[model samples]
Target: MIKNFHQYYVYILSNKPNGTLYIGITNDIQRRILEHKQGLIDGFTKKYGLDVLVYLEMYHNVNDAISREKQLKKWKRLWKIELIEKENPKWSDLSIEWND
Candidate 1:
């Protein structure tokens, strides 16, 4: 028997500190972030220039990740900001160094 491992991500992107935010979930965080950065995603993130990865959560189950993403999307803006700030006080792009 073989066991397969999988990962899912719930992520938040912002243009800058205290800026417009976009929430999403993906099985591949790096690829998803790259797509957003390259403007391949034609929606809120691209329109708002929200390429900075300010917050992220990982899950082993895709369903859990999806649920969390939906929950975050429904949260108040201030509450979301607080959640991001709790883990990323500077609102820096967590994926900034991925290319290098």
Candidate 2:
């Protein structure tokens, strides 16, 4: 028998351009982003308002996503910023239209 699994994502959120950045991995990217946007989950995201989904990289395996997130977390701030700019030069909230 075979089972289907949803893709995982390493996502980055920010308060503003050149502002605070938060990196995380999730299986349900949209739901996680919504939670961050609504301040549903407490801690860094809520306190810093790091609610703008600036970047995302999808992975077929959760292990890959977890590994990427960990690597991003250890990167120098400038490198992470560069990664975000590569796809999202404007640092737009990529999750704002998840419902659409």
Q: Any residue pairs clashing in model 2, and if so which?
A: none
**C-alpha lDDT values of all predictions:** 0.94, 0.91
lDDT of 1 by residue, 10-75 (tens): 999999999999999999999999999999999889999999999999999989999999999999
lDDT per residue for candidate 2 within 1-100, as digits (tens), equals 8989679999999999999999989888988988888899999999999999999999998888888999999999999999999999998888866674
Most accurate candidate by TM-score? 1
User: How does model 2 score by TM-score?
Assistant: 0.93
* Candidate 1, residue 99: lDDT: 67
Clashing pairs in 1: none
TM-score of each: 0.95, 0.93
**RMSD, every candidate, angstroms:** 1.0, 1.2
What TM-score quantifies how close candidate 1 is to the native fold? 0.95
